[model samples]
Target: MTVAVTGIGVACGLGHGKTAFRKGLYEAPDIFSCLTREGRGPAEGEPPFIGVEMPEPSEVLAPRLARTASFSGRVALSVLQEAWQDGGLDDIDPERIGLVVGGSNLMSREQALAARDYSARLAYVPPRHAHMFLDTDICGLCASTFKIRGFAYSLGAASASGAVALIQAREAIRSGRVDVCIALGALQDLSAYDLHAMRSLGAMGSMRFSEQPGQACRPMDAARDGFIYGEACAALVLCRQDLAAAGKTYGRIAGVGLAVDGARGPEPNSAGQVRAAMTALVEAGLSASDIDYVNGHATGTPAGDDAECETYRTLGLEEARINATKSILGHGLSAAGAIETAAVFIQMKEGLLHPTRNLEKPLDSRFNWVRSEPAVHDIRRALKLSFGFGGMDAALVLEAPDSGGHTS
Candidate 1:
């Protein structure tokens, strides 16, 4: 009961839709223009930083929804519309479709603000309906948007949420929970409070790249500074085999493997992540040689980069052409997996894979990290790896659609 992906929709700092995102991947690194508050940015002497910034939700979405939830809902609807147009669902009932969304932070930002205002002596919080913030509940937000009445649930696994959604969607459809399932993955920008808290703890990256907005996120390069934070919402529509027979199948989800590093704190076990990759490869009936490209989860952090490099070495997959997209789109937290998945799908369709940017020196000699140009390959199969905080790891095996014909 393998689930096949028929359509995909993504919104990120790069842009919306396939064309916009891909264009951002090839462009030179530039600083991102951030306007959370008017006239409030870097105080002179900030490092070059570019982010995949989305437009204000009030302009792009309905007025009633929260920013984060609206973005995720829009992505789901876009994918569903594309799936319907991809030549399927003519016979399927719209009521039977389902949704499983992954969200890490949910409405914590809004909730925490309200709680703080209530507790503060000088609390000046405006008279606003705090209940609008209630949909900050992950399940409530997603289910309401997609009208997924058959089945709906939310997953929270840090950056691994997207991969988790893929796994859950595959199983639910296989188990007869529903005929169609659209997996949504999303993350939002840090609330002002979150930023201040992270800065106090010395966890936030300094805005040192103010001179250059685009080149701020440099992964695998020797001059890499730190992770560039980003926000995004992405979704992939999947259906059972019979339903897909009526529609065009973009690709098939052959197998998925999840592993835990068991490493304490921020450090992840590189070896464990690699093991998960190998398991997915095996489960998909593929060999290391069969992998056309590796969509890496390198966040430009010192420890994360080191662990990922070590894993590549341990897996003996040094020959594989690797590309770290975080360098282009910034790290979208929970949405990173889904955004990268969408990027990989586009690369497969376009027959090209973009390289990591701003790399003057190679971090690992064994693996080729393309920085100058997109890698051209007959990508029949792709391996996407995501390793997140708390030692969570996930690997997915995606394959091109089967050719319509008899196999001797």
Candidate 2:
């Protein structure tokens, strides 16, 4: 079953929508800032760390909900609104639509802190309770706002949430469960408690301890210490060609594969990632030679980048033009893979591939890395990959619409 991605929307550290995100991908913007601790931020006296902040939404939601809305909810609403318009979902019946949302922990620090400090007494009033307490309430909120009443699901596969959500959404559409589906991932919590926990886990780059905000993340480079923590949200509308007869399409999702290392650790696993890639290739009915470019799951960490690189090498895709978008936009957690797939569209449409930034000394690899500046290449079929903390690995094959739509 083939699924076509008809529309794409993004709100991340790079900026909002396709234009800004594409510009950041190619030009490599110097976009990083310290986590704000004051209004609308985490707690006070928290350790300061540099991260990428998404720009304010181009169009704000209703003031009634905005006043008390969680950051992740706002981001999700904004991106989904853009995607709805982009996909022309108005043409389809509301009852025929479904949504699959991908996210990590998204809770308001103030609300959680209040509940923890003041007991369950502060749990509910009306809207506040709906946003956090209900597992599917967020999905329902988006459904109600979009008038999509078919079915809704929420999933968390850590950093691979975006990719896993897409895989599931595609299958849902293929199974004839819905005529249209929305697959998205977002993260917007800046709670000091969360940041402190992440940093203490040693998941962040050493540059956070210094003043090198511009040089914080160095994916696939020898000097890479760790990944920079950040937040973002990205969404896509999926449907079959018959449903979107005249709609615009970013690309056709040819195949997708998901796997786990079956081990408990944060280290990236080349074996698991390799299995996912090979499975995607088999499902797409294409060999390694059919892939023109690769968007890896590398997030500047030593073990993660090395494992991803080795995975590609083992899969016989080393010669494919490779890119590490985190080098430009930083890792956006759940939104990482979706936003990176959006970059694949720009690269294929414009025949240009973005390079990894700040790669002063690249690690030893046989793969052809696009470094320093944008490289012109005819990227027809690309592979976008993602890896999560729990050893979850995902890979998706995407091909240009004009690439014959041949899968088998």
Every model's TM-score = 0.84, 0.92
User: Residue 174's C-alpha lDDT in candidate 2?
Assistant: 89
Supply the global lDDT for candidate 2: 0.79
Best by TM-score: 2
Candidate 2 clash pair list: none
Instruction: Supply the TM-score for candidate 2.
Output: 0.92
Highest lDDT model number? 2
Task: Supply candidate 1's per-residue lDDT for 348.
Answer: 74
Candidate 1 residue-wise lDDT, 187-262, digit = tens: 5545555555544444344556656656667777765656777767677878876677644677777778898878
User: Across residues 136-236, which tens digit of lDDT does each residue of candidate 2 receive?
Assistant: 55586687678787799899888888888889889888888998899988664646665666667777776443576888888888888888866688899
Model 1 compared with the native: what TM-score? 0.84
Q: Which residue segments of model 2 deviate by more than 4 Å?
A: 37-47, 108-127, 133-135, 188-190
